[model samples]
Target: MTVSNTRQQVKLSDAVQRIQPSGIRRFFDLASTMDNVISLGVGEPDFATPWNVREASIASLERGITSYTANAGLMELRSEISSYLKTNFGTSYSPENEVLVTVGASEGIDLALRATVNPGDEILIVEPCFVSYAPLVSLVGGVPIPVPTSIKNDFKVLSEEIEKRITNKTKGIMLSYPSNPTGAIMVKQELEEISKVIIEHDLLVISDEIYGELSYDSVHVSIPSIEGMWERTILISGFSKSYAMTGWRLGYVAGPEIYTKAMLKIHQYAMMCASTMAQYAAIEALKNGKEEMENMKVSYRQRRNYFVKALKDIGLNCHMPGGAFYAFPSITITGLTSEEFAEKLLLEEHVAVVPGNVFGSGGEGHIRCSYATSLPHLEEAIKRMDRFIKRTNG
Candidate 1:
């Protein structure tokens, strides 16, 4: 009687099950399974970690400094981070109370959402955004609202759009400049305008400046540093992009003390602290890696220019990205969905790009090409993409 041959399906938590898997990853998985593929799909630096930064981590290991670091990270490293922020962006944070190190900027994103979001609260997310933001908001029981930006406006999130979307349920906003898919940045005036809206709405902000050092035009402005904004903005940044330390998994959040305290509590119980060796390496990076960081930026800018030009030459309309390593080019001319374009481009030319809609709605007619690789690879990817475009158009 107990052995009725019935197989039952296991269920996932509805909260987790309802969120869609990242669209950015499918193409990445497809690209990896193919040979001789040039991947412009992932936003990662191709540069090796600077030799000195690597050496510092090695030195820490040789000295047997492998114990778990303080939950807030080493004081020395935090101090250096504080100094780097001030010197570079004119922003200040107290190492003792305002910064909490995490595994990566991704963790910081989670901790920030967890600290502030309540069920049914709405978090305004700008599109085209990083793929993680919307899901992260949903995971915290918050509604993720999209504020669509356009290529015609250089993809900057307009304050008017943000203002229009604000309702009594709105609790916060999330911004990433040197934005992921579009690589579009808001100049200080634009950010200042957006900050006005944030202030008027009395909204908290989670500002992702992970690509701060990669700005190609004007300097990257941290929203928290703007007048009246420090009280409301949570700043997220890390070593991955700036110092080519992606695998080391180090990032941090700096904000008002209360929010930092809340995030730190969640972080200690959930993650404890970031890697000890990585923290030591980051200390060295903030102290001496500026030149290396700039060199990488210079390289990326050249590739960005070359690739955007090449895409234009192929009859695809592309906006020159102001920062980060990605160029968002319109694929509407070929009359293909973003996924159709990316999948077919990979199969046809062995060149991989992320379909832009993965980022958000405004990205529907576009594809994201990362220029973080070498100039030669970018040139070749362009040639392959050009052929694919012609064949599709015909």
Candidate 2:
């Protein structure tokens, strides 16, 4: 064999090279390898997939329904999702034209960006946002423009702020509420203001409402439900957070026929379909698992309350999350950077949390602690955090 250095000469895409590994994953990797580490870092709900939903999956398998579904998804699952959205969120869509089941909301996000974004197009993402949005935008040759929200404003983006970011290159706004990390949610009034900007700017909206079913004080409001917004909005939601089906890997997107058709084309080529058994389970979740979801939300609410109170008592500046199972607390009082606080807490106290900067610049002074763990683990983690803070400060 000839001596060749060709392996080192391989060229990689700019998009791939620019992307960074997720900050959230670093702590998870450390926690996984450590003993007795209490992790508040994971974003998944701790509950098992409800028994009925699980049974549905098993039934599909026993019935030999193991083949791939249509690229868009099984008609039955799409129909169920359409009906669920209409009845639950007051958003109407035709299953045939509007829905495409994806591996998860993660895939739906990537598909939407891939289908819509041209090189150098801009995606408006709110901070602190989900970790995946920026990288996914980059993967499709789009630039992610983050609009920072503040804890003082309850992390809601002002309409004026959003309007200021608009430019000729802007293609869409990626909105995730009951947001990951921060758990900040916008009420109908806030969304209406955002809707006005989207309307005025003629911008497409990618609404990630995965936490729609988990709100504590109020119901979620989808921008697409507002008149004039539907045509330009793609609603991305799934059973993962709400139905405790994270491991099932099932989600879908609903939008106008034209946009959805394009997304479906990309999804067809990329994922083909979501998991077959998981799709059946999701149908049951949408159709008959409302009570189960409600119960899980109640548990999460209780945990949220407990965790917030504990953080406050430990001298952490915490805010009550309106939706989702996270508490994003400012740790600046401890005179520690977000990453420093997280690393010290993990190594010294065996408690794990994701640094706020992992989400974006707006998350700089904070850390995200998920209350998705059991009550006992949450209590123990809080105690460990308190001890660590005292020892460090002293």
Candidate 3:
């Protein structure tokens, strides 16, 4: 090694340069450094993983089942997932050929994009969408075309809007319902209409149904279940939200065999398999965790109602979220941008919420408040937020 005046420069892929740090993570990073911060920033569920699920993982360990699984995952787990899908959503999938187990829905998103998109292809993303989709699309050399939805309609994307955004370059659409930032979900009829547009355009759909089990008022619809849509739709879901198993990092994607096989190839090369123990635990969750999932849904529904009411009472414009655990309340009444409102609230009241603009352009006037925390924390956060708002307005 010679010491020289000129140093070799490190290089990164253009794809890496095109992406930015997640906006949601920035708020958490700042909140972590402060004391007594009540964060509704991260979307993680606050509940502990259910006892039975934990026990299953422990049992797996006790049974010496700690080896790697097949790249597509264990056959029995896949079969359970396939059965669960049929039982819960009335969708049919062949576990042996159409499902690929992934590290998380995050990995499923990346793997699907990696397998399907080529340079300059466009992926349609609805605004106020999950933070990960755009970056992942860019990473896979696909252009992210965001279609902004409105708060007036509760952030629901219309079929016409989707049709308007399609172009010759459009390759697919990314759908996230019981959406991360907005908590908006598409009912069965709504999804059927959207599916028609997708079918007409001959486009692929990557449906992120990670929060499918958390709906409050109605059933969560899967676009793939619609006649003629299953072959073109890739459904991404996981145990993270529904089972409160974020740390377990278990998820899956089910679709036509042609696409899933391609996705599995990428999964096989990039990460051999999801954690073996987690997969085994997930098998138990799929097989025996229905009551536990329902219990969590009940608690989440109560918290969602409480927080939405509190926010509205405090003069923020809020819609009662139909699914997931977030309330996307407009911060405009406070006379601040979503980011400014969030920053001031954190500094003045030690309450943390993510600015809606982090999701996309349509979220500019809103902020996302998660009710995934305990009731006590939610109450305290509301009190602090009330004081901060009154003081600022006064």
Candidate 4:
């Protein structure tokens, strides 16, 4: 039979069609196309990976240890990861069954959502949060219910807010502390309050503590370490943030074997395992990179202090970020939406930032600026931003 005159287009999956492109990437890509643009957009550390960690990976390669690791990852790295989490996060796991190394915390997210989310299941995402959480939940056929948090509470998700949103369809909640967009963090007491709600609701938790090491004033608390949460929380973290190992693409998921085993099955099919060389490097980072890691933390803390003050001094009010390297400042005084502010700043001043609304509710009228850069760069960016605001507001 002859084909019809009108050609049919390849059908796309409903999941793929429903998801929109990353709002962060749109500005990042646009900035990339330009020169002399100082980007406070991407949330990546500026520090180089510690020398020992890099040397370990190089040594591994020299020894011809380039084979694919077991689907669950190299057992040695898993044990080290287990130890690291226990010491730092106060949460323990069995390296044998409770840990699965993946490509990145990003991949860990995909695995966790796919493994747990059933069609129509509702995953409660705390908003003004990471952009990936809701979309990943949606891609797995789960409904992502946004629980909005505002600057009034320093962007912390209150227990009452969580309790009010719970329903029969609610399966679990996604939490990111030292949050990507807002740099908001919940203290142990705050998390405990929310933990009570999660326990009462008998819900699962996906705690993205990738930025745990970047906490400024207080220790980062893991949900699994809280009472009644060990059995329900899946802890996702990795070398990307703490060790400046983003390019290494190494991350691990630790939780009850029931959840991790499911993630492993998916990891086996989708990714097989994380890089062997990176796993070797991560082992070194955990064992001997603490001094360098702490040094980076000190530098970030300095940058954060300077950047927050600089933003406020320029009349863009910002909450002092408790952790991570981002500063989400309200640009409402300039009479511009978040998108307009970010676009104009990038085009007019050649300084790049991510618009807040891209991060979900409570993000409107704000912009996420990463201070994970040199102090001089951050200072200059702020000066340019101040100039732009003065000129715009006038």
Local accuracy of candidate 4 as per-residue lDDT tens digits, 169-244: 9999999998988888988898899999999999999999999999999988887899899999988999999999
- lDDT per residue (tens digit) for residues 159-218 in model 3: 999999999999999989988888999888888888888988899999999999999999
TM-score of each candidate? Answer: 0.97, 0.98, 0.98, 0.98
Residue pairs with backbone overlap in model 2: none
Q: What is the C-alpha RMSD of each candidate to the true structure, in Å?
A: 1.5, 1.3, 1.1, 1.3
Query: Per-residue lDDT for 126 in model 3?
Result: 89
Candidate 4 wrongly placed segments (more than 4 Å): 1-8
Count clashing pairs, candidate 1.
Answer: 0
Which parts of model 2 have CA positions greater than 4 angstroms off?
1-8
Q: Could you tell me the TM-score of candidate 2?
A: 0.98
Clash pairs of candidate 3?
A: none
Per-residue lDDT over 93-154 for candidate 1, one digit per residue giving the tens place of the 0 to 100 score: 99999988899999999999999999999999999999999999999899999999998999
Model 2 lDDT tens row, 169-280? 9998999988887888889888888889899989989989999888899988888888789999998989899999999888899999998999988888777888999999
**lDDT, model 2, position 218:** 95
C-alpha lDDT values of all predictions: 0.91, 0.90, 0.91, 0.93
Number of backbone-clashing residue pairs for each candidate, in the order shown: 0, 0, 0, 0
